[model samples]
Target: MNETIRALLSKLGGLPMPVADLADDADLYAAGLSSFASVQLMLGIEEAFDIEFPDNLLNRKSFASVAAIEKTVAIIVDGRKVA
Candidate 1:
């Protein structure tokens, strides 16, 4: 899960921050993520995880950090893959 998050973060910025610099509870919005880019990120996450994010779940809280995203993805994926 961390690896997936790390990969996504890597593609997010050009300055190159270490993955360890991010905490699970960190606010990605404050961490330099632009609002427009965040939506693009949502698309990336959905495509990568093969899951649809709930309409009610579409909020900044869900994209707070890598850990937060992982948790959301886990719930969205619902333990089903190629069944």
Candidate 2:
């Protein structure tokens, strides 16, 4: 899941530095993630994970870093199984 998130970030993050070169906790916004790009990234995540991000998880903090995104996706995916 982390690897897939990183791949999606690399393709969609729009950061000045490569996503692979970034640490898991690196601030994606500081690395050049624009608001528009974040939306695109979210869309890509939804497609890749096949899970819709609940409205509650759509926020700056949820997409703040690779770890955050990974955690958020895991929560959503896990919730889907119990539904």
Poorest 10 consecutive residues of model 2 by lDDT?
12-21
Q: After superposing candidate 1, which stretches have Cα over 4 Å from the reference?
A: 13-16, 79-83
TM-score of each: 0.77, 0.96
lDDT of 1 by residue, 25-80 (tens): 77777777777767777787877777778887788877777778888788777745
lDDT of 1: 0.72
Clashes of each: 0, 0
Q: Model 2 lDDT vs. the true structure?
A: 0.93
**In model 2, where do residues sit more than 4 Å from their true spots?**
none
Overall lDDT per candidate, in order of appearance: 0.72, 0.93
Q: Per-residue alpha-carbon lDDT of model 2 for 15-64, expressed as tens digits? A: 88888889999999999999999999999999998999889999999999
TM-score attained by model 2 = 0.96
Winning candidate number (lDDT): 2
Q: Where does candidate 1 clash, by residue pair?
A: none
